[model samples]
Target: MSEPLLSADAWTDRLFSDGWVKPSGGVIAVQEPATETVLTQVGRADRSDVARAAASAKAAQPAWAALTADARQAILLRAADLLVEHAPDLAPWIMRESGSVAAKAAVELEHAAGFVRQAGAMATEAAGLVLPSSPGKTSIARRVPLGVVAVISPFNFPLVLSIRAVAPALATGNAVVLKPDPRTPISGGFLIARVFEAAGLPAGLLHVLPGDAEAGDALCRDPNIAMVAFTGSTGAGRKVGEVAGAHLKKVALELGGKNPLIILDDADPDVAASNAAWGAWLHQGQVCMTAGRLLVQRGIHDAVVERLAAKAGHLPVGDPMRGDVALGPLISRGQLDRVHAIVSDTVADGARLVAGGTHKGLCYAPTVLTGVAPGMRAFEEEIFGPIAAVTVFDDLDEAARLANDGPYGLSAGIISGSVGRAMTLGAKLEVGHLHINDQTVDAGPHSPFGGMKASGNGTRISGPANLDEFTTWRWETVKAAATAYPF
Candidate 1:
């Protein structure tokens, strides 16, 4: 089926009877990898738009905060049900709008559904504990919503990533100002907003403002915005941190990752090879936790490399909407150029392209590289494309040590049959999440997802940890004893 094309005179943030307009339009716009149709524009937003959104958020937040968690949960659950009902509507847009393969888009929707359910359940149940400070002193701490939160999500994994922030923020009573990536806005925010509106959400609690940087900055730096949650690249994350810090607002930023995947000598060839292929190639390797580096023990390096290359070689790089392409285009041509530059520089630095370091338009084949060094561009940079670099190591200790060598410590994978080896390596590896015998990004709704070091700020997705990100703790020490105080 062909994607629904926008009307001739579409503009940014234009509201319609059905849904809001996507700013990206016409020829000079981001396109779907499958059919190469204009999905949205990469337009800019100014300070005024930000201020208006912020004002709206500030206005609507109190009513949202006044509602019980159970009430909020009910709304969220209704939204979840709506999402399931509209999966048919959503699936196409996700694929056509985000350049995501149908299968990957389905997985993303499933992740969104799971996260919504988890968040709904957590909305009312998410609470802080009362700690026993001293003998007679009551140290009871209660969790309170931060009033207003700003969520800025990227184009890749738009539905899932945006929801991961929105669910928790809404669940915790913070009215949200969401700025979805202009490149692929697609009703990711509108859907949530519609659900909230249907659930009798207060006027200003769930504002969806999808635009470019100036607008995003306004929301982040707004005085009324008590918290800011952003997920993007390292460069943008830093800017968000700066603005958020200047505002004295709490912020959680999940930035870039140049992840590593380690394969031990004892790992199964079939499992390790398949896992590594998907981990590196899925979503065209645009994942923040994509295995940019694959380190294999020297004893098994040759076998692992051969298997990995063969697997990557066999993987399809077809149209994303076909549900066949194991790979798709990078988010943009700019991103493709960056990946290309990295591959070129690595090749110049003596890395051998074992297979598929090539491209056609925005699409690139799943590539495998050998002879990568710590100092090379591919090793140092976040190659957010279907290019996996394999380097052989002599020992497990050496692999662990080398895995921790990079600046970005988002996530890492270990392929080993030895439980002890996997455990040891998992512990020692300097990353936020570690996987054993798995070659995929974190499957998280129950697990916390974030990175260590420069990979992220003090924020996470999923599990109990996510709800706490958009809130602050307020101590309410009631006198159950009816006494003055303890000294």
Candidate 2:
């Protein structure tokens, strides 16, 4: 059966900064993953276009920052309201471009909108405290916007990931020039620009440039852009950091992860297996916080693996628009082939495929593997697919060791019958976010989400911390009378 079409109004190629602009360089044909059809065409912005966007943001920053905090807050709140009003139109674009199922797509829409509202609240809390100073003098510190920001986002979870930076930047009075991944312009960044524009954001405060990596490089190198706020792979983030660092520009990075999920011996095998399925198979495991490593205590390893394999085989996989399907096609053929290649290589190196290591086009079957050890590519790398590798651990120490052995330390999950034991073990794990009696893949607009070590650049992205990422603090002192002076 032919899948239903996405909303008609969103199918266009125009770009927006101060206003809608026609494409001058090239065009990018966005393909629908489920049907392999050309869903829409977006502008492929070049270096010159990026420079123009940066300049526009620079020009708009001061006026935006000077506005009353309540005014800026109202605009962002209106943008949030607009998102909910238009979710039906926007959700389809998310599904068509990012290959997200309806449920996940709805979550993305609501998360994006909720983030904007939360950011508005953060704006009211951006004030600093007064400190003690010399006699007859008062000292104070105040938080201020960091001028223009360049936001580079990824394709998976396009709406929330992109909005995660943009909404915070704007709420803190910083203008932003967003360069979304070419594969997901409409769903990722363009809708955000439209909502803010309708909500009466000043011209040039929020710009959406749909293009490739070259455009992102241009934004990073531009002097007018005060900082770079990025969400993507660690490999690409390293390059962005290098450029921004060389120019002495501030940067906030939310990068990759190799998350671990541990199932204690006392836990129910069926319940643990079901949670594992949800963590590893949602959106075909494309999430940065997906549970890539499964560590099970020896007593329940065999039984849990059996149940997990059975769950993998039972999940419905097909078009994302289908109500019954649990798994959807990957974003593109390139991703599909990359995931297949990793699975093939790991299976060749003694990793036993307990259930599935197969694919029919972009829909790779939910797979479960056992005996995955150190040094194997699948064990060491981020597969970014619906594949879970299990490792048997003899004790809590062994489980913690296996979990923290990997380079990435984004998130981890512990499943135990005892809450005290789970909390004890959770403290030992070297991850930024820990879930007690839950799966690893989780996030919320009000939560301060990021990672430790290589997972992020020592900066927070959501909640009140988001305001700190996009703004700087300045100290001031006022003397009531002239005391002794050095000059």
Candidate 3:
């Protein structure tokens, strides 16, 4: 008989602290969202376990910081190489655990490797600045690592989300205690540990804990942790920020988005619809930057809606691990129910269900609704599912207003034949990322990524911004000798 892909023999079922060990909180069964089958059981960490992990991280951080920059860079670079080398094994684990299609899983693996490599390259960059000072003295402002960082990542795109923070934090010389969502512990937590372990990271410098809200809350409040980096929903991010703030800890949040995609009158209906369809339904619309609202100018509204609806209906939906499909399934039954409720509620509120509004088990058909107004549930809420609610606007003024109406300001896109017009309209929207002539669902390894308003705090992540996220500024002054003071 063949062994399981992530067998206990090949991977530890225990959480990593000082070492891989059993947790006081027993174990949680990690399920495959598409089939609703148990993929494996992983150790769950409790408050006590979080305490131990935080202590381990705090103790080991100084040594990690003390290492030469080249030493740290080498480990991160090797981890990136290892991730690419292990993609065959790792991609399947991500697909089975996260219900991502083969293509999406592949993209996640590639992006994660890029993020690690970017961090490795950043490690050797200048870490401080020299400034003008009074005569006979020198002033230097240096970027120093936060003592220990706690990372809370979500289940969707688990590998990419977790590593984006983990690699940069480690590269900046901070120890990390990562709490991945319980649903995707293997890809989010275990896979990271394995790669860094193989890269020869020092023991106690990195810990992976798969736990529930209690464990996460405990991690935020732990005294030893100096910062918290979180990627999840807005409600959860608010709680994390509040708790972490109370402890005077620096927090970096990449939260939810009800992102908008605007189609101008001059845009080609087919091309605009394609961009909207890809943005809204990609990965079953589980991405944080998924286009939740599609605002089309009145001149092209009907054409765009018709094309988008047709595209949504034709896209395949099934178990991705078994065969080729555009989308797999929602993360769980609860998520599926929430998505359906929003769709049903929106449809009932007089929005026309143009394409789909049905589900079988956890797989929801890509859905589209037209005549969706601002007050509708689908228009206001972040329906993190395969549903696209589109509304019409008479002019660019109304379009910008509609796009900016929602509480979220994560990502927005403007599709127009006139690039200047799109740029003019996009500049007015209160979003962190505004793409001209493209979709909102785009990111680069070196691009600064985050959200605004309810989507996230003002802080950013990735690229050169990581130095700011994982480190603090320290100022020092040197003098030829102690200045003599007169009383």
Best by TM-score: 3
Which digits, one per residue and each the tens of the lDDT, describe model 2 over residues 1-487?
A: 1222233344366678678776665788989988888988877788888888888889888998999889999999998988888888888889888888889999999999899999899878847879988777889998888999899999999989999899989988899999888889988978887788788998989989998878888888899998999999999999999998888899998999989999999999999998888888889999999999988899999999999988887888888776668888898899988888888888899899888888776888899989888877778888889998888899898888889997788999999999999999999988889999999999988888889878888788888678688889889899877677798
- The lDDT for every candidate, in the order shown, is 0.77, 0.87, 0.91
Segments of candidate 1 deviating more than 4 angstroms? 1-30, 40-44, 126-139, 479-487
Q: Encode model 1's per-residue lDDT on 1-487: one tens digit a residue.
A: 2232333244343522123433321222546765556665433445655666677778877887887778888888877776776677678777777678878878887888888888888887838787888776678788888888888998888888888888888888888888878676664565556655665666766666666677777877788788888899999999989988888988888989988888888888778777788788888888898988888777777777788788876877766765577777777778888988989999999999988888876788888889998999988888889888888898878888889896788988888889887888788888888887786487678988888899998577778787668778898775557764687
TM-score, per-candidate, Cα-based: 0.90, 0.96, 0.98
- The Cα error of candidate 1 at residue 423, in Å, is 1.4
Q: Please say which candidate is ahead in TM-score: 1 or 3.
A: 3
lDDT string for model 3 (1-487, tens) is 1222345544346787776788999889888989999888889999999999999899999999999999999999999988888888889989999999999999999999999999999999999999999899999999999999999999999999999999999999999999999999989988999889888999999999999999999988999999999999999999999999999999888899999999999999999999999999999999999999999999999999989888987888999988999989899999999999999899899999999898877999999999999899999999889988999999989998999997899999999999999988988999999999888899868999998999899999999789889899999999989978997
Error of 2 at 169 (Å): 0.8
Steric overlap count per candidate = 2, 0, 0
* CA RMSD of all predictions: 3.8, 2.9, 1.9
